[model samples]
Target: MSKTNLPNESIETYLIRRRALMRLGAMAGLGAALPGLRAQAQAKPATPLQFVGWQYNPQIVAQNVETFEQLYDENVNYQLIPGEYAPITETMLVAGKKFDMMYSEEATLARWITAGWAQDVDSMPDVAAIKASMVPVGVRNLSLPNGKLGGLPYYAGYGSFIYNEKHLDQAKLQPPTSWAEFLEQARQLKKDKIVEFPYVSAWAHQAPSFSWSLFSIWYSEGAKVFDANFDPVFDDKFTSVLEMHRTLYRERLVSPDIFTLPQEGVPSYATGQHTFAVIHDYDQKVLNDPKLSQCAGQVRNAIMPGATRSTFSWVSMYLMGAGAADPDRAWNLLRFFGGKAKDGQYHVIKRWALQFGLGTPYTEVMNDPEVAASFKSWKDTDVALQQLQNSTPRDVGKTLWYQDWDWYMMGAVQDYIRGSQPTSALVADLHKQVGVFKARYAT
Candidate 1:
């Protein structure tokens, strides 16, 4: 069989054609189900498909599963793996467990593909449509080096500046348009006593939050931690990035409690204690919830400030296991989660985005009027799309040793933030550690 080619269209043209296709498919009684997938579903009785992923929301997952079962007549045994997702997934795959469908991130997917554990998603019948439906970041992450599709892009979380608009108003300040402007505003907020701490860091001593905070600054400044050869390339640009954070710590503009805060700086921003924060897309949703946040309706999302507006991009993907008992049924189920249904809706990813504030990579869903209307902040979706456009793929794509590299870097950053290590010493140590990791892990 030949490989499927996805349509490449501008945002406007894509939306127009997508809408037309939906109408045409519905009128012809075809529904939005992929052609070959719909036929396969009707030919067989429902069978149980084991699905695993990190926890999203229990109720939301249950609702989606229930809907999927009713629509396709398939039973889904969905499990939310506990503890760190990457390590847990690695253990399961290494142990040779059978999972028909698995939820994964781009980094984890890269490792799994290299280990020969992931099935090429391009073999699925709907590959063309799926590719065309997603944004560039999704396409780049899910497609492997040989041009084979590795996974179905589910949802993406991009970094952005989420701030308390009410606090900024009180201080007679606007959201900063550039990195220099951001520094100026931080100083102004402190001078005017707008908030005790104008900025908060989610620099927790762990995989996700630590890396998320570090990369938000690193990428926004247009710096790369690793070169094409996967060698650690520490330069003045990297030094400048670290020094920017050091300055914030020295000036007391950032919360000192960040060192011990396991919740990733949400408390500071949600309580209106800090006027500004760098946070993921979902963090924006959390801060907008009136029941969960003191700032609730007053929160707004802005593009990250820097010489070039760039931020870290994360993807949650759906992969077919290499050892699947039923590849056909597995493909059907995977399509159910990532593809549009008979009603022209992406039930799972759409609900996930609405319940949480994370962005879906599906172009149609992202631009849907109803979905846009559901966000508390009018600009949230727009800012998210903009960030995704300018995003750098999660660093794992650049190197398989991302987990090790991140561990060493996070430790050094923690020490530097706490004044246990100076900037010069931290830079030197980073170079040394990267060299060590490369020697150990590089093939």
Candidate 2:
């Protein structure tokens, strides 16, 4: 297999640095770039700032990079890592690669900071303004374990409950306000033959959306998976949640193929094959788009159902690499992408929101009339934003071993669903596993 195919490869097998796999740009002399670091107006060397990110929208990224280059006269050598972005980037870093800025996910941020690959931005001059610009959850997600701001948001959003209004209306049912109600509604739809599977989910093991859906349900039911001490505390509420899944699967209310599906089962809802989904807020844009979804005009958003009506939120970021040779230049680039640019406007972040339906951390961007108007094209602005307020970041993400634990948890969940383990056994095993990881990563 190609080195880029590492996502499916075992983590232990690829931990070693493979120089042949890296495609980084040439490194520049720190002394030569020091002047440019002090101020954008200062004389600079010919070397470009090295910036790297995973493939998402390379054309948009290139356009934004070109705009940054034009606006600041800063040279940037931008590169895209093809697969398993964090592991590849970490391998590159371990191999002594240097870059000014890189994309980071919340699950990997703690590990990056712990390994000294990322620099905390709390000491930056614009830190206060940047913090003020973002939502509370964004700030929390971007912060290091030490409470220092680790980076700025590339995008921040929450998992939300989305439903097909057409199906509900056809069944003469209202949108659900609680898990009990939700299950009843699903049954009604299924019984009426509105759809074979009235509910759909992206619960495939090892899929990122699985974690999002798992936590969103846990939170909606007021279950804290972990305590402040980083211990697993989800045992009490986990049985009900797990049972809910079992009931759905056994009764044929949810698709039997959901275990293998990817990403919120968008096509199931879009094509009107399913009535309900719990997906990230941005996906609503796709789910409701006229060109993309057959249920375009029928899809609508609702805050997740439960007593608290809560869900899990998260952020991906633009982190300043500790290995950045030109700290100020790197900060400028990070700010340009994650915060406001020299023009005092959030050009890139705003574009990510308005153009792509991605969420933003900036209060101004979130409240922008244009942004709200844009959301109205695909989703309810109030429900979407309200869901943001009701969302909370996963505390376990602060651990260096979070990704490892998350992977194990996903497999365990799958086992539980398959009846390979009982609820008590599953919860006990999960807690024991958390303790093992905690002990292994202890200071």
Regions of model 1 farther than 4 Å from truth = 1-47, 342-344, 376-380
Worst 10 residues of 1 by lDDT: 1-10
Q: Which prediction has the highest lDDT against the true structure?
A: 2
Residue 119 C-alpha lDDT in model 1 = 77
CA error at residue 102 for candidate 1, angstroms: 1.1
lDDT of 2 at 34: 20
Candidate 2 has a TM-score of: 0.89
Residue-level error in angstroms, candidate 2, position 361: 1.6
Alpha carbon deviation, residue 410, candidate 2 (Å): 0.4
User: Candidate 1: how many backbone clashes?
Assistant: 0
Which residue pairs show collisions in model 1?
none
